[model samples]
Target: MMGRTRMIGGLTAIMMILAMCAGCGIGGDGAHDAVQKLMDAVVAGDVSGVKNLYTLSVEPKMPTILTGAKLKQPIQNVTVGESEKVSDSERTVPVSYSLNGKKTAGSFKVKQDADKNWVIQNPPVFGQVSFDPDLTIGGKPSTKDNKFALPIGVYEVNMVSDVLEGSWTVPVKASSGFDYQGITANKNRKKIKLTDKIKTYNGSMSSLIDSFNLLPMCRKLKELYLNGDDFAFISGKSISSACKYQTTDIQIKVTDYTPDGDRDGYYPIKFDATVKMIAPVFTDSGENDDVWTCQSVQGGRQCAKFVEQSFELKDWDGLVSQSNGNVYYRLADPDQNVGELADVIYAGHGVD
Candidate 1:
């Protein structure tokens, strides 16, 4: 009976030892091995290998951003330390590696998947990010300190801030060891004042109108004057040559300026303006049938028969401008008919 009890006790002790050994192997060594593989893949620039080692949750979220991103300098002398078990299926492993001949240490959290294979739980963080809370990353609000532990990838940063009253969008590339200062410190960020924006819009208005060939209103009036009972007397070409539209004394009074709530760098302004369009009519002088009527003026001739119109325009919107000097305005609204200039007019309105 004693011999049988001893044998049973020995078997139980052996089983317990084997179970503990198995647990240690999978929980500790497995995580360290996985990290080592990851380091190797990174050094070799094997993106596929690196991606395969990531946990399922992290792999898909970062693949596009990680594509084509490689370190400028290869990581060398990578040593993965022993894994500290967090749970039955998780471990935290410390790693040291030389980059640019400088040694650095970091930690990686790893977890076991259903297959009991260790994988990286967190995506590799690439940069030290500090930015204003008002700025958004990938349309999500940033934290106060803005230390974004984002995976290696490119992200669109919206620099529109209520505090700064600035609006712009910029591309931020998150790469290994990148330091992203807030948009306020970014050299590429552009912010234009409301006064400058208004000035730019007003200054480019005439050219904007002319480029769109919106003088057809004046042309139509000339066509009406030239029409006679015996078929239309003026040819299309003749009407074009005889009538010209001139804009002067442009005055704009902005009644309200509203910044776009959703999009940065877009403003809808409501304003009233008095714009003068002078359409000169040329007719044959009684003295000479072939000569058009004209009176000498300062530096130019004043047509004897001409139409002068002063337009009191009001409630205009969809005037969009960027700090890069790009100005876009909607001219297609039926209420604001300047004659098919364009559905939208794009002009460069750089502040002087």
Candidate 2:
């Protein structure tokens, strides 16, 4: 949510700056001259001149947040917004520059940098660079371009191919719109790649995760949770979801593999999940979405819901994994019915 807000604000600011600079005598050369003047003023220790060029919230200096020489010299970073070309003027344009740690106001400008890089030149009546990303280099605070950014993190991948079909790789990559929660919520979550290729059936390298859902086991586990039962003995069995139960069974599936089927990472991670209910006997098979209270079974477990079996998912080659990497067995017995549960069970890799 925070990132989304910033993106919108950033775009808006870019557009505004471009529109205003359209009248300036701004161009590449103008930008250079503007930047050089600002830099010279800064190097000459002219704090007022620098602040005058900034678009502050009125007031030439932030007496409290940032003041005088502190803003122009002691400052650490400046972020120059993208340069806008002036339509009529040959040597003028508008740019936004932010000073770091100043909480000061932003300013508009017209001009170019000393290195011929574009820049905003005018002096503000009472502002200074308060938060410019371009000036955020580690060693030199007065510098711009902050240079290129490097990525972090390490990843491992696995891919399996099909004879006639394409293949699926771990961490399946998918087609994602601009990742918008905007009104046009493009609900279609297909897998598309950087090269613009739609991975119809084969996943590349981003959507791989294995999962299992033992509903009966979960219901039973939930009962244990309701009764404050703990089955901490299961190795790597950290209580994941529905914090109330001890696990009776777990149904997990591998990412690149399918249940009697095949896996293609082009789709979101898919799996059959289950939740078992153990309680005094919450409900019998065939009830609407509901949760009731009851006594307990012989194993010191509460029986808020009576669940006899788990539910297995069918035709699950394409679906999304829970945003949560953890299990979601918490809401198990909201509608407890223990009849004819179709939960999936596996035997390999210590899952049995």
Candidate 3:
């Protein structure tokens, strides 16, 4: 969990570059002033101040949730870099909010409004969302003449199984990614038997099924709609996963709980290590407050140091995902070890 290497150097570099550009690029008093205001707004999560500096008309794009975080280490050596103008309307800035000695630094974006107020808009998540391999790369020109800011990863997917055995299995994670690792007690990969008990999925259920994963459902859904063969047995590639969507649920499961949440859906925010990350919005089970947050003592900074946050740009009532897979967290019920084992074993078979 600590040391994860990204083979995509160009992609990683681009992420760094974009993050730098995000911090706001300008070295001097002006840059410091911008950074100071932005940091204060960010630390306090003052929507108004952030909006004013970033020049946002409507509510600015804050993180999805501003809950608490567990400082696995001390958060110290806080550093703020100048903001640089990346585009006519945007600027990137570097910030390192550290604790103890461990650090997590990233660049953030500050965009200018028509009236010229620098507003922090783009969250790092936008970059996290760009995994499309068809994405253009390098200085090379793609068919659309659009150059991707980074190199795309080859989204390869496969399925392997004793076809003699009839069963729906999930792909297992191997060194080279997903691999078909036979069947186990965890998941009952039936051995060549046409049984009525089959776990079948269609395009309509999960809102998040892109054109890629839907290949498995082709038998029932008809031809493919998206591009690419992120799946195993499937052939041909499509353009995008716009064909699939995500699933919807009302159960609120919190991990990193925080109080500074948008008017959006539920989020997990933990206070200290106890309090059991709660989301008052969905469960209405935890304590309620206008603004919830995490608190921990470290390096004398009390708690309240902003760690992570989320805000829903859409999802008025909680229809968060048009498809499925946009789950809050991958958790298991304490009462069901067998269920977990089967699920884990099921992940071995090829998705398609």
Candidate 4:
């Protein structure tokens, strides 16, 4: 009776081991099938499924990485190659895939998580891409005129599709230096158009100061339409409505300029500004008055203590115009003082 019981106990233990192996997706044949599932998810652009194949740490970046990959190439087919176990909890997988009619081979390391499910242990793959005419982002130029590696996965590239003038398999990150990363223009590379509306951008201190008309060097503001239009230059009076601010006795002096050490094309500008202004307007003075009132009058002191801002301007001479030896520029956004002063002036608070 004792011998027979031992034999049965050994058989039960073997069965339990097999079940654990199957559950963790580590069985002899299961690893191949798991890798095949991941390849299918990628080819099908199954974002959810592909995400499930990787651990949680890599989940957040997967979307951007996938978007860049989709723009770089199209995966037509994927074949599972050699796969071997490195340990009880880890395995290596080799795969060959067809992209844009080209064959490429890649390797992956997959590991079993605490949940006993297999997950991809390698960072997603990305493809290299560049612009044809070359462009700059946030005043920082792309590598080697216009080349950089795209992030991995599925995504769209339409911000400047019209401007690029060619259809590509993958989307490209919009040139930097704008308020938004994906903000783009459909105009020619050299003849890009500035929006009629004043807006903030990222770039160099010189570009910001010039663009905002912070100093007197900018005079007789003009718009240079690079589209070969005969107008060439438009006066400040003509585009006054499009400008951010009009100043009277306004002075902007740069106190300091600091460049970012780690990243290119970024500079922080510190400035001290004084704007002459009439006192704020007030509708009522006391208790029942709805508007907040400090004092209502004309001709008062408005001094900015210390203000710091960052800028990203790539095209200075090209974006602005220099004629009669005076440089002219339009404001990208409303100056804080100018905007406040405008309100005061609008409310009948003018210099006495």
Better of 1 and 2 by lDDT: 1
Q: For residues 179-202, could you state the per-residue lDDT of candidate 3 as single tens digits? A: 112222122212223111112212
Question: Which stretches of candidate 3 lie above 4 Å from their native place?
Answer: 1-32, 44-76, 99-101, 124-352
Regions of candidate 1 where Cα sits further than 4 Å from its true position: 1-19, 22-28, 56-63, 69-71, 98-104, 125-293, 298-352
- True-vs-predicted CA distance for residue 89, candidate 2, Å: 16
Off by over 4 Å in 4: 1-28, 56-73, 100-102, 114-116, 126-156, 160-352
Instruction: Point to the candidate with the largest lDDT.
Output: 1
Query: In TM-score terms, which candidate is top?
Result: 1
TM-score of each: 0.37, 0.23, 0.23, 0.36
Worst 10 residues of 4 by lDDT: 216-225
- For candidate 1, give the lDDT of residue 332: 29
How many angstroms is residue 24 displaced in model 3 relative to the true structure, after the best TM-score fit?
10
Q: How far is each candidate from the true structure, as Cα RMSD in Å?
A: 14.5, 22.1, 32.0, 18.7
TM-score of 4: 0.36
Q: Measured by TM-score, how close is model 3 to the native structure?
A: 0.23
